[model samples]
Target: MSDGPRLPGVEREADEDRIVCHVDADCFYASCERLREPELREEPLVVGMGYEEGETIGAVATASYEAREFGVESAQAISTALERLPRRAAFEDGTLDDPDLEREDTGYYRPVDMDYYESVAADVREILHDCAGVVREVSIDEAYLDVTERTAWEVADGFARHIRDRIRREVGVTVSVGVAPTMSAAKIASDFDKPDGLTVVEPGNVREFLAPLEVDLLHGVGPVTARELREMGLETAGDVAAADPEPLVERFGERGRELYDRARGEDDRRIEPKGDPKSFSRESAFAEPVEEPDPKYDLIETLADAVADRARREGALYRTIGVKAVTPPYDVNTRERSLPGPIDDRDLVDRIARDLFAEFEREPVRKLGVRVANLEFATADQTSLAGWESAVESDPEPDSESEPETGSERESGAEPGLESDPDPDPDSEPDPASGDRLVGQTSLADFS
Candidate 1:
């Protein structure tokens, strides 16, 4: 008996046997901005990575389609993007020779706000979960849904349209969807028409659907691979599909065989639902490296508070707390401590993270992070209440002759054996821009 279904001869009936949908948010970051400021919808907008005052170097996270028409692209340096699509200030000041012609064309710029984007992503995920039995969240802006049981080719287009419309109406952001019999084909179809596109490739058409596309358009085929494929006289996916698999395998190894299979629309991957996160962490990078121990310790406290708050929101208790310190020139040093049991104590997370970070106190640090791992979602009774009570009771009482210290004083003063660190001003806020680039440069393999 065969272990499973055979491949080459299966295509005759495979088209009608499966229903997979890939949904990609159209210009996700820019769309998120438009949701906040509707006026930006008509204007060219560029969401860059630097928004903090005096920060001049960063990359363009995403540019609206209008901005892209002027040669702005995601991952391009912010400086380069400004040259193509000058800032509003530049237009207002008549800095360019064609200032009158480009004055109204000045692009709106906003810093990346990850927390806000994540909140928007959560809303989109909720809608996806409602659409299919199994929905795989690939990233903040992409997902794949297995709707084989919900709809067939006959109504797949309508189903996809409903998803697109609902996302626009409910979430205030547009998504492009592709419905196909295979995951690989579905992903490609999703990008067929973008910025609110819906493309469907039914079972029998999968081969023809992928045939005329460039080899580089296929998932997993990068620039170098595309060039090599061209050298082998394979310019389009059709050429690779028809080429000898053994020679391709010999040339590119297992990846060559994968290329051939994907070229023929043979992906069998399933939609895997998103599960609980493995860990929770918060990291902060300094605008400039600092040698002072006080600033580093203060940043760690802030990171610990953020992580602990997230854990509490998720009703999770962690047994391990860790700290990451990135020194000058990008050397990462990490230390973790595992507790006797799981606990959700925020103060404990702060103290443990600080203790773990103590070794690098005097080092010039560029970034700091705090993380909690080994998570348990059970009730608080799982922790050692008796031990916690004993530890708290063991603290020495304040001297009657001394004045009581205020909360701010206690926070600023370090415990015995720990170096004193200045508390950061509560009014000062860090830039919310994240390190993640936007959806435009993401690979098709990411969705698969």
Candidate 2:
């Protein structure tokens, strides 16, 4: 999130306005599958996690709209989804005619292929960069673009249509776009029509556009908050918008004010193009939590190499090397070692990450992560560690016995990286923090 577009020492107008567009790919993972095998376009598809060679259970990552009709949904256990939508193979030998098969539709299951989807996402992002002066990539399948200076409100719809058409023509995936005066409104409008839909809310219509919608449709209003709002007799955005500000503020603190403002279409957050990241991290989760040291160390080695490779590609260096371990039931612990100055030493990253992660060797670890932070972009130099003892003394290690926090326990914000889907795939597990991009203030619009 940026404070609008501003140069150094320049004052921004208090009433500055901009045209923001939120573009979201439709059922991205499923769409990618259809792209690969066009025969599956009409077939119900379910992409799952943990579906390897001898696994009875996995989790649903994404389901095609057809699959959703069968009550299959993202994040539901694979076993449950299978019960609702039987595998296509079940019907291959004339089993579809069986009276005992309650399901009317059979579905295909594919393991999540993150690398392939990422490659597709990169193509989409390239087009976004060309379409706007500033583009904020929220996740692999969604982004926000500031096109205020590029096009007027009258032509914004046409502008959006052009983008949608191009993506379909070039990338083979249809995208829904919402064009509005604010990011929140844009997000809602984009989802207002989905699967290659487009909706534009003119400047003055923001309030009316949001007023009749359910409160849960608003950004950051999750199930718990929606329930609370309904319990308070605030059923729609209109209710929140018209309620007394003081009571709402007192009840929800600063967030209440944000809710009120958003209901009234008052978001002023800018479309900040992701700049240099504060850190580089790579993570992988186990199919099942492992308590052994060798497997965990092997994962650490792979992650360290990945992060360091990314840093080298960006011509960046770091002074801190850190490792993260997530114990069973989602407890997260992080440890880091900081040097006096930044250095892009790959071996050093590997060694330090392993040293930091050594304490968690015997713990029931569900996930592992390696991060290099305190970044600087300068040429590498051989610097002596004469001051290493003092540096270590100044920055004491964290308590090794402390209970780790879950991913949700940490602060939420947009991190600089190619946003990956939160859902894990069997072959390529995602970082526990991977899906944070999809949940918070900057998430893709949730039409449902």
Q: How many steric clashes between backbone atoms does each model show? A: 1, 1
- Report RMSD (Å) for each prediction in the order shown: 16.4, 13.5
For residues 1-448, write the lDDT of model 1, one tens digit per residue.
Answer: 1122222323323445778998878777777777666777868888876533466677776778898888887666677777788777656766656725656667878877554455455556656655776666555677778877666667778889998998887667888899998777887888789869999998889999999999877866656778889999999999999999998999888888888998998987766654665567776667778888888888888988988877786678887787777664544566777666677787887887787778788888776878788888875464543456455346522211211111000101111111111221222222346432322222112111
The list of candidate 2 runs beyond 4 A from truth reads 1-16, 50-54, 93-99, 102-104, 276-448
lDDT of 2 at 282: 67
Model 2: per-residue Cα lDDT over 110-150, one tens digit each: 87665556545655765675577677776767788887756
* Whole-model lDDT per candidate: 0.68, 0.70
Q: Which candidate leads the pack in lDDT? A: 2
- In model 1, the Cα lDDT at residue 288 comes to 79
